[model samples]
Target chain A: MALCEAEKTFILHSVEENFRIDGRQRGDYRPMELETNIVAPSFGSARLRLANTDVLVSVKLEIDSPTLEQPKLGKIEFFVDCSANATPDFEGRGGDNLATEISNCLSSAYKSSTAFDAGKLCILKGSKCWKLYVDILLLECGGNLYDAVSLAVKAALWDTRIPLVKSVVVDGNKVDMEVSDELFDCERLDVTGAPIMVTVCKIGDQCIVDPTTAEEHCSGGSVVVAVSKSNFSTILQTGGGSLHPMTLLESLKLGQTVAQRLDSTLINTLKQINDNSTDVGFLK
Target chain B: MSKKKELVSKIGLRLDGRRADELRRVRCKMGVFSQPDGSAYIEQGLTKVLAAVYGPHQVRGNRSKAQHDSAIVNCQFSMAVFSTSERKKRPRGDRKSSEMSIHLRQALLAAIKVELYPWSQIDIYVEVLHADGGVYPACVNAATLALIDAGIPLKEYVCACSASLANNDIPMVDISHQEEMLGGPTLTIAALPMSEKIVLMEMSQRFHIDHLPKVMAKALKGCKDIKVILDEAVRSHVEDVGCSTGWSNTSQKIKV
Candidate 1:
């Protein structure tokens, strides 16, 4: 995947001219195809393909005790699995490091209070609460994995439905919750504040979003800017190399602007998907 | 097991309304992905599996493992965490998955002409997206298609199927998950259907010693049926490719 000096210069010249290798402008995102309810038996699931990067996210709910430090708040955990289908290098424990890195990014993105409201998941406060396990499976890696994964997670959470707690009986020190028996009697999570990550790759003197793996190789440095609404939840500089402070600020501004548009477009796509009848998934 | 559930109804129908010798509907497609040399997706009833085949190229990693007389066959069987009704802790590396992988390699080795390609390796990876039953058999069948798509030479079509003895007299073929759980004595066989040779056979629970012949026969018959279906698919696929390339019409035209 190493590019020759001439090839690197070609990419640098393209970025400097405000055109990318994929023939996209610096701020334009890759065309994305999203599908929800692809996984059965899970509460909610979404599969997204951003260019060649493929991600499947599923949300499973479990009843567990709330953390002692956060008595009124529920928990959300992210787990990423890099399937060997993506590459032979991801076999066995070889993918563990990359999986951990992605999961860490996801968890950090949801840390800000404005990013996700964990309190809404609470049931019987400290005694009982619903734990949301967001499991992401990376099937293929073309590039811009962070952006694809974040979009999929947000769509899955939007599709998720928590059963209505009909009653909570607290007898002495014991408490039990009764959820509604009806399958459709559930509440959807408010995913408006869910973080949408934007990866800004610095190639040459200009910055670009959604870098393909080939473009990523030539990137001097990349910052993953996770924007929740109008605020920044987490900003992590990933991959090799360094960037100047002024460039970092400029990238952040670009990331925020692109993420806001991404969030609105994603919400509209999900709404349109709900009205559709068929989901082809990988079968197509 | 209180009053063990009946695998066959009073009217001689299996749990899924299939006949004693019927297989669950199998639908498959090859060349599903571009990364692997060959890839395929197969669905046996509700169970879905994707298989990918890579290489007969130079050995990866350690070079000492290469054999001069035969190519190495490596197989991995993994199930998605959300594939089943309950979530799995991990996809692969479990003892059951390891055993399944070994069994897959054994079955595939019988059909692939490995001796032709020495000092090389072939990697077969199967991922189960849905796990109803007959997971191992589905993986074997999927891998066979993928290997063929990779343009590797094979002796014959290798197929796997499961059968069970019901009511001590009736032999059922192509056991589904529901029937597998309630049926008595399940037997699975992988074979070269065209050659009428069994490559591997696995059994669970127990059957009367006298019933072995009947159950095994039923399983082998199921494999033959599966081969017919797979052959039809391959023929159609080849025809489709030929038509796209104008060979189907132009070749005949050139002859006339």
Candidate 2:
């Protein structure tokens, strides 16, 4: 992914002119294809492809006791695995660092109650709750990983169905509950406030969203902003190179506006996705 | 004592309505990704796998591991965390995955023409998106297709299949997860179908030694059948690509 001087300069000039090597404007994203419920065994699943970058996300639920600190709140954990099929460089333990970074970012973004309320997942306060295991698999890397992973996670959450508890009884220090046995008798999670991440890359003097691999290589620094509805959940600076305070503020504004637009389009697309449509996973 | 469940019904149908010798519907596609030298996706029943091949290039990391006589074939078998009904804590680097990786390498080494690329290496990676059963066999089959997609030379197509004895008399091919859990001896084999040579064979659980020959035979027959399906897919894929590129390497007089 190393860029030669001439190639870097060409990308830099393209960004300065408000155009990209892929014929995209500064705030425009690449053509993305999304599919839901591709994995059969999981409660919910999604696969998203942004140009060459591919991401798969699945949500699995398990019953467990709530933590002592948050008895009324359920648990949501994010785990990211960088598959070697994406690149040979991710072989063995090579991708651990990146996986950790991405998972940590997601956890922080979902930490705020306004972004995602964990209380709704609780079945019995202090005794039992539903633990959501959101597993993300990185099948390919074409850049813009943060944005793609977040979007896929949000879609998977939207597709998740929590089983309904018909009855709960507390006897002594123990808790017992009866869960509905019907396959489709479940409640869907509300993901309207789920955060959507946007990566703002600064190439030359201009900031761009959804940079390709080539564009990423030519960038000096990048900012990742996770926006939940109209509010910003988390903002982090990545890569090397420093940014002026004024420039940073301007990039934040840009990321917020773009993330809102992306979020609305994603919700619309999710609504239009027909449940009966045949799933064409990787075969296509 | 509790009554035992039948693995095969009296009418000669398995739980999934498949016959004793019938394999699950196998569908595959090659060249799924542009970044790798070769990539492929395969679905055998509920089990889905994706494989990618990168190499025939210089050795990476440790140069001392490079051989002077032939290329080193490296294989990795990984399953997604949510691949099974129960969520796995990690995707790979476990005992079962390491054993699978070794077995995958053993099977692939027999078919790949390693001598042509001396002092180099070829890395084959397989990711399991779903694991109904016959995971190792699916990984080996997917790797073979990915290697072919990469244009790497091979002695022949190496395919794998799983077999199990049902009702103490009938042998079933391509065992699914439900059947595997239903108390039966399962036999898996990887073979060079063209030459009818067995590359690797493994058996789990114990059965009468007299049934070994029949189960082994069924698995070998399954391998050969899979080879045919994969060959047809490769041919059709080549035809599609050739037509798009105007068939530069193909002779005009020859029927495509």
Candidate 3:
């Protein structure tokens, strides 16, 4: 939707005044509810609902050979499915494009060795490694999809437990590994330094942290920043418009600052979720 | 499949302890999401399915596919990778999923009054969150609730149920995943309960022609029982929706 000049100005003024149309400030996030270990059959699962947007993340683990290019590094892949439950527009293959876009962006953000150490996933160098398949399902789209998806993925990964391997033996080209029999004998991934993505929507002359559907439609462009604990992992500009160099630099600064707070809040919330609680799905 | 016991017997009751014609417990909630025009979640036994409806909008992609006489009914059947005992590689568009999607559309079209909105399109999406058995029937029932929640006109209530001939004698209704693996010829039927007409029917494995009449009749009876459960759910949902909208008026009267 192309907003008229008057509507654009009104939105910009509202953001500057610290009161959005949905009664949230520029720095305030929408009401969010999260639950973990909902998909019982998965290694780990989490579902997050931020206002109207809903995302379900499930993690599955498989044993596979490490990539030849990075033998020491195990693999982590992201698959995003924008289900038609979010909207009928996603029927059939309609959601494929959006799903691919989100998954590709996530892969780029986490592929760096320093960002997420895949080496920890290796049971035997070049022989056997744990491949983490992070599957995300988008059930509804209210707004701010990027933030909701990122949070759910991080929570699901934190809940994942990798079974401990007792022994590994290699015979020529054959590799054999024995996993621990005890159900509780497992290793948990250290996800304190995981990246959190924040999107800054530039509407008129103002930049807002979390934009609503109406504001998103009014914005001319937006910038997505994926920030780890100490540094920015990836920066990408979306939409068809170009931002001036100074404006782009300013937006990056905003994104990085917001992402830092987001990362801390997510870590604390996930810890509480790991304490064990029942999930109510969409009932709430 | 070798001769496994048709159903494990314990005091003349099947697994989970019900009569031969009994169905699994059904619990459902409608209008579950705000984004979709209509949404519903249903649980039958261990099977959980969510159905959502979108549109009466323009035909997406190639416009030529739109029919002039009636609105197009598009159906997509997807199961969560973790829904099964063994994880699935993909959710939809696979051979089984594609076939299920086609069958769902056929059964729904028979019930939906499509002539009311010509040249428009309606999309029904069913997501299986957990699959124990009889996923097709669960999906159809969930979709019917979602369509009503969306206020789409229907000719009649469409309900689906499955039946099986147990040990070549007793006819069982609402077979669970365990019963399905116990070696029996399974029959699934989707029918209009009011009209007493079958819209879609299918069978797996083999059954003698002489036994077909009894098996089919049992399946139809199962459908009728399911239809009553669904109708109750729809009525309760409507009451809830109406009360929420008239909350102020109702509250004022109570205060008076």
Candidate 4:
């Protein structure tokens, strides 16, 4: 997906005129399709296909003892597997670097307790807590992976339901929790404040949102902003190039605006998916 | 006698209510992606696979590995983390996936006309979206479609199938996930179906030498049958793609 200097200049000129190669406005996003509750057997699952980039997210939860340092807070871990379906380069351990980078960004974005509220995941103070494993599969990688992965994760968490715990019995340093047997008996997690990531690729003095693969290769650098409804949760700059502080601040502003819209659209879409009467999976 | 009776019951049907030699319904689509040079999606019963082919270009990495005789064929086998009943720790890189990768490369190398592009590389990437059974066969079939879509020269279409010795008496073709779980000696083979040449053959569990020949022969028949289906699919796909570029005068509009 390499772009020559001439092509880069053309893209810059188009962006300066507030247009893109695909006829999108500078702030416009490509058409996206999302589906939730795709994996019926899992606690929660969602697949987000933003144009060519496809992300499938599944959540698995289990009750375990809380860590010694974070007794009051439960655990939420992110694992991203870059399937070879995306590209042959991802075969074997080749995709490990990309997967690790995505998961690290996600863990940092959700590190703030206010962003996810792990405290609610706790069951018995220092004794027991729910561990949420958010496993992401990269089926296709067209570009804008950060934003797509975050959107899918948020939707999956929104759909996740912790099984109902009826009661707990503790005796002789042993704790037994009675989980409800009814299939529908469950408790939903609070995801209102979950952070959504927005990637801004710096292309020829202009910052663009959701850059395609070719655009990404042409960019000198990029900034990833994770925004919650309240405020910015984390901001990380990636790529080989460097950015000025003032420019970084300006990029953050752009990210903030784009991220707010992204969050609202995601919330509305998740609602629509829930209200609909269809099962979501790759069948479609 | 009781085991044979159990395999083919009063209705003389195998598990999943299919006859002994019946093949599972196959559904496939070509050019499933825009990024890859060629891409395909396939479904056999509940088993689903996606394959993408990326090259016929200069060899990547070490030039020393390149041979002047033929193009290097690279194959990768990966399963989705949630593709199975239980979550997988990793999608690939395990010994099993490595072996599958080797087998896939071997089969494709036999089918592809690699001599045309000496010192080059052709990548075949297969991902199992859902693993019911017959995963290897489905992967091979899908990869063949993708390679064709890439317009890579091929000596012939490579097809694969799985056969099982049910009740140690009857040979069942196209074993499904349920049947594979039921426990039996499963035989899998990839072949150049038209030429009737075996590219790769594998077996799990043990079978008597007398019964092995019949089971292998049955599996080869299944592979040949699948090859016909795949060939038809390739032709139809080419026709459809050809019509899309305003080359064909049919004036039929397709909504892709």
Indicate the residue-level lDDT of A34 in model 2.
95
TM-score of each: 0.94, 0.98, 0.92, 0.91
| Stretches of model 2 off by over 4 angstroms after superposition | B248-256
Scored by lDDT, model 2 comes in at 0.94
In model 1, chain B matches the true chain B with a TM-score of 0.96
| Tens-place lDDT digits, model 1, residues B1-256 | 3487767778999878998989999998887777778888888888888888888878989999999999999888888887887778998899998999999999999999999999999988888877888898899999998998899999999999999988778899987777776658889999999989999999999978899999999999999999998888777676776788888776563321
Query: By TM-score, who's the top model here?
Result: 2
* lDDT agreement with native, every candidate: 0.89, 0.94, 0.86, 0.87
Query: Pick by lDDT: which candidate is best?
Result: 2
> Each predicted complex: what DockQ?
0.52, 0.83, 0.61, 0.44
- Cα error, residue A63 of model 4, in Å, equals 4.0
Q: Would candidate 3 be rated incorrect, acceptable, medium or high by CAPRI criteria? A: medium
lDDT, model 3, position A166: 97
Between 2 and 3, whose TM-score is larger? 2
Query: Over 4 Å off in model 1, which ranges?
Result: B239-249, B252-256
Clashes of 1: 0
What's the C-alpha lDDT at position A89 in model 4? 74
In model 3, the Cα lDDT at residue A155 comes to 87
lDDT by residue (A235-276, candidate 4, tens digit) is: 888877988788788899999999999999889877776445
Candidate 3, residues B101-160: lDDT per residue as tens digits? 999999999999999888889999999988999999999999999999999999988999
Model 3 interface root-mean-square deviation: 1.4
